[model samples]
Target: MASLLSDIRTKYNLLSKTQKTIADYILDNPDATILLSITELANYCSTSETTVMRFLKKLDYDSYQIFRVNLAKELIDSPSETINEEIAEGDSTSDIKRKVIKHTNTAVSDLEYSINQKDIDQCAEMILNARRVTFFGIGASSAVAIDALHKFGKIGLNVNGFQDSHLMNIHCSHMTSEDVLFVVSHTGESVEVLNAASLAKENGAKIISLTSFSNSSLAKKSDVFLSSSTNDKKYHSEAMASRIVQLVIVDILYLSVFMQNEAKFYKALNQSRIAVSLNKT
Candidate 1:
């Protein structure tokens, strides 16, 4: 079913001042609106109950109860209205393109605002100067860790990422003060990753956490914390946007490290090229 209050807002100019007030209240607090009786809604919006009844009828509902039931259904079915709201079908290609651009732009802007420059610099410096860098992640985050290892390794840094929990624990146990441990988790509360970070800490390794939330357990345990932001949808399906933010942070770290030690970075680059050329022959 269509959103009743959105319809009212779209036609707001046509609504009476009393109807408008009720409409605004319903839009702002949809869940609470569903729970209120017609009399309660009238009192809450400072209008007569007759106005509330008229408002529901104007929206094509047979009664206020039906209107509220439909609204509650909408809320229950879509917990995050920002992401779950349906887009109207477009009749032209340009209309579709415009919608796509708007969505992408919002995601990009969200990521940009969520990042902190100082955190990025600190993480890069720690990794660059460390004698060894141990990357830890599990499941989806493990893929990120492996990707980070590939980039950091190219810049002449010793880096390793482990997916297996047992292997991760074994590696963390060997980390020392001269080493750095980078933990990646979207939730920042993954049990295996947190345990690994704690073990690395016990061994005196400086820990850096890359997570979506700064207040997560992994972040609290780390020596430095870097976070990426994504607009969470109803199903928490912000993975695509979140991954983009994470990769951006990773790129920043990689470049910072490269710039901090330009000579070593370029030397490693040349060596990698030579090795690839030799293998191709």
Candidate 2:
């Protein structure tokens, strides 16, 4: 059930020039490529069969047929889902608004399809039982971690979000088997996040990762992994859609925990609401 398309997209930049050319063609016309033989695909890409075979090897496929089989399966699994959303030049405000809404809706829909209930249950249980929970992210991801801290902390959980690498490392150093670390990284390759996760794991804390890409370093290190949709559109490329999807997952986690033990957390939730409402003019 490994998705060849996801693998290709996740590692596209790491491929060689010839391999990228083949990858581009395949991504553009995956349905067509699935029906084509290796020679046909090579000719279509204006590359030789040897080059195509090399590209397959780069993808870690033993044979082109297996690669094609997985590609076909990916197409079947995803159907018409596309991460690339188009915003045309000289479009009106309404046009941009509609496109943005559609893209965000698609991302949320994909999350509903991508997340597994078992993973959610396990993560919720970990959060419920952990002595302390730590959230770690950097840059834009730091905002996400901070938001998670607010949500989880409001539930009476001993939670903290660390933005500084040194602070996160220090926190991890004091962590024990009763702690849980939740990491948010779109690429799962952030040096600071990885360092914190490694140190936390060494200190016997459970790690939960929320990432867009599967088979990433953070994903491999996590006790629980949750995937989100990619926001790779050319026009809005600052991970806008990806961040929304991640926040939604955080909301889901928060709700799951609250629903499981509403009586225990209800007072804290109402207090948070009352505290925020006090600021109203």
Candidate 3:
């Protein structure tokens, strides 16, 4: 929803001259463009409606109305955040800070566009109804797996996390149809994670994956997959950036499950807070 401007910028260099003019018009006048009808926008761009429609088609927008709706939300959410992830060697700490914030904001906005809310809701339903939940990940993704374990366990969901591939394989072999195996992988093609996911599926567990690539094997293997916007090749920053997306998705699913059963979850959550507080003082 909020990825319109980002998509425009990404495809800017590839656009035809006329399309580039349309791109410039939208990029420069997002607010005004949202208010203008398609013909009016075409008029403002000094282009025909066919050219405008063709431009939206390049962006994968099926209808002008939906394009405007998403574009309006994009403008409201992040009107001026230009996504620049490439950090040069001589960049200042301040520059790094700004770049990181901008990248994260843009990544999240891209996620808002790419991710499916229905899939999220379905995942929430699957998780909340599952007899037990298991999380699996490797390397950097292991941290997110453990975080999910901690968050869901605190709220009284039967949850565990396995970072060791061998352990994941062994544990997954025992999963039943009532089980939900939540896998975390940045690439979604991690060999170990996929092997374990396959094992879990063979044993009749519902698999849900959080990954950047929707077409990845892990995503294809799962009952539901949540897409993260860490699709860049910035080796130094990709892992770190994916972590931000991972944490946001985890929090969203966590909140979804909690809100669905607020009274019961609030009681469990309150008990957890009380128990943790006892050791603090």
Q: What C-alpha lDDT, on a 0 to 100 scale, does residue 182 get in candidate 3?
A: 98
Q: What is the lDDT of candidate 2?
A: 0.83
- Candidates 1 and 3 compared: the better one by TM-score is 3
> For each candidate, how many residue pairs have backbone atoms clashing (under 3 Å)?
0, 0, 1
- Assess candidate 1 and give its lDDT: 0.73
TM-score of 2: 0.75
lDDT of 1 by residue, 1-281 (tens): 33554345333334667887887677657878888989899999998998988877767777887888878887787655423121354536675555444444544554444456787788877887799998878877877788899888876788888889999999999889999998889878889998899889999999988887666788899888776644333223446556666777788788888888798799998887787698784
The TM-score between candidate 1 and the true structure equals 0.64
Best by lDDT: 2
TM-score of each: 0.64, 0.75, 0.75
In the range 1-281, model 2's lDDT, one tens digit per residue, is: 33566556545545677888798788668888889999999999898999998888867887988888888877788866443346889989998998888777766765655678899999999999999999988898888899999999887789987788999999998899999999999889899999999999998999999987677899999999988745355688677788988999999999999999898899888888888898997
Q: Clashes in model 2: which pairs?
A: none
- Local error of candidate 3 at 267, Å? 0.6
Q: How far out, in Å, is residue 204 in model 3?
A: 1.3
Q: Which should have the higher TM-score, number 1 or number 2?
A: 2
The regions of model 2 sitting more than 4 angstroms off are 1-84, 88-92
